[model samples]
Target: MIAIIADDLTGANDTGVQYKKNGYSTTVKIMNDNDVSSSMFKTSDVVVINTDTRPLSKKDAYDCVFKLAEKLNSVNNLEYIYKKVDSLMRGNPAPELEAILDSTDAEIAIVASAFPDNGRIVTDGTLLMPDNKHVDITNIFNTETKRKAVNVRLINVREGAESLKQYMEGQMENGADIFVFDTVSNEDLATISDAAMLIGKKKIFCGSAGLAKQLGRKKKAEQKYDGTVFIVVGSRNAATAHQVRMATETFKLPVVLVNSEEIIDGRYEKAVSESVEKAKEYYLNGNKVVIIAIDSLFEEYTVVLRATATENAKSLKVAESLGDIVKRLYEHIKPVTFVATGGDTAFQICNFLGSDGMELVDEIVPGVPIGILREGMADGSSMVTKSGGFGDEDTLVKVINYLMVNRK
Candidate 1:
């Protein structure tokens, strides 16, 4: 039996569904009560706890995990345990839990988000890579453009920051000019307008459908940006992309609408291959390339692979095969820089490069987790992998902007 606990029903459901699909008889329980007994824990072979709802202080979180581990210890049948804390900033006790784990001989895996306010020690989480069978697009760039400083901005919406980071890094050998600004309300839009005035360049605003609609209503004459590209990328339905495209066109911006499904489709390998061909042409034509991908992971690719593969042996085989493919591809492209998002993607890429497995390095800002692989340190060959994760779409865009401006 596996017990998964979360602060809210949504997080529990998401994590539970994954475990269930992985052939485990899982039970998802909301963590409302403070007291859990060994007898209660003995019923499950594995236990998962969500630490988001509890107070985030190191001592508080440590107490909760310590008690839970004590309860699991009483149940000799417990083989594996996982604890998930949703937010790092909202009083997560990850540091205390790590310290306690170091001292104890507990068989447990802990995963947590390191929101900006949280300290470094508590931010580290286990990295899980996808199976080898899946194909991933690392750094994808288009033709070189004459523009020296490209301004990439995202409206403060859902999951945009992380998505934008992947897309921008994919498009250029080096990261593009990126900026993160809030556009959730009128005040954010005004702030963006003020910033645009200070740094005048070609500004591309990326956002979901809802944010694009809000911007449409504002119609602030001063908010117009030169060479503005509105990228409509989100996990929502196709309707959202269409709506954003329409709104951006109303402003007469050079909008390039991208369908999230098209980019993230299982056929990503093929789509990216074609995109790369186009990029080569653009590069040959002397245009600086800027590529942006948003909201790529709606459904976990791991679940999809597990469902498609006939057996666990086949799943592992496919994952290994994918590693080989990525290894060969990296050798060929030799990109100057690479950026990735999410634990699974980072792990898979690192494995492909035959690097010292995947490790959570640091949090670039709040809600964004960065994973790094040192240059020339992998087993097979040296490959560079720079990736980060944002919990939602809005943050995805923020990361893209941050990278665009800061890319060295």
Candidate 2:
């Protein structure tokens, strides 16, 4: 079994889908502060555990990865382990990589955080822009936060992994933790993978989705569909609310703003049924996208916030209610694509559908990826899970248009 330690749920699914597409039965666990149970995972193959530690401090991130790697190592048949960092290098990856190396038997840590498809590349051991501009990897880490003292060095991929490994060993003699590997294209990815596989000694790998995608990738069957796309707003953000309003008014999409007050007042079942039926009314009449947002129907979001004692509790209830609505909608018509905003909301819907981890195929906007449901509902159904705070105005329009254009 292979264990992947990811920093977030979306990153977990994106990397796990790489293995799943290549014929490995992979499952992604939204890990938290809980007991790591064998029954909670698919023991026969790959398991990607999401630590959800992007927002955590360096020390906390390190502890989380160290504990998770230690707990998962108890399971036999461990093929390999990798730390899935943010492709754009947003999280506390340095410490997490260090933690994995500290806890596991891995001696060398090789990192490749570039995906050329997304225009991220590594040139001369530093991240490069699509336009060949060098990105100062140190700037993001050095000034943003206080990081642990480790050997922050890189290896030129042109020299090959054998040389890189030798460099790592030399640095290890000096107490080095990890070495960032250079990769400019798919060929570079293959070279790195080949080098890692040939290494006689055990080592940890630290990389982004690009490396994972290349390690075990297979072509998916062509999407076969002419279907509607459902957009469910499960997170509260002023930007998303603006985009939702834009899409509804400009595209004339039907809006089904769920009443959060009713949901909080012991009226969930009826609220879900009514919302689904109303959305279906427009959906059956040929509308492609239906907006399901809470509090927008009866009151503004600020009013809802003022009424609720705990904002998180309200969001959780609304997320579940929206999930119930989507589950009911699936009974009537399976959407070609489902856009679920917010992490908890997406997780709830995915758990309800009994889906295997997501297979990331494309992206609608920056930091927002669209992936296929590996197991649940239909074979080609696509899902877009976005955090509530990301994306700009017209982001929803761009998302829906992208879905419509690619709704195969």
Per-residue lDDT for 140-209 in model 1, tens only? 0011111222323333212343454344444344543422232223333334334433332323322111
lDDT of each: 0.33, 0.68
lDDT digits (tens) for residues 149-195 of candidate 2: 23233344557768755655566677644556657777777677777
Q: State every prediction's TM-score relative to the real structure.
A: 0.31, 0.66
Q: State the displacement of the C-alpha of residue 48, model 2, in Å, after optimal TM-score superposition.
A: 1.6
Error (Å) of candidate 2 at residue 281 is 3.6
**Whose lDDT is greatest here?**
2
Report clashes for each candidate as comma-separated counts: 44, 1
Backbone clashes in model 2, listed as residue pairs: 225-408
The deviation in Å at residue 312 for candidate 1 is 9.8
In angstroms, give how far residue 27 of model 1 lies from its true place: 33
lDDT of 2: 0.68
Give model 2's TM-score versus the native structure: 0.66
Please give me the total number of clashing residue pairs in predicted model 1: 44
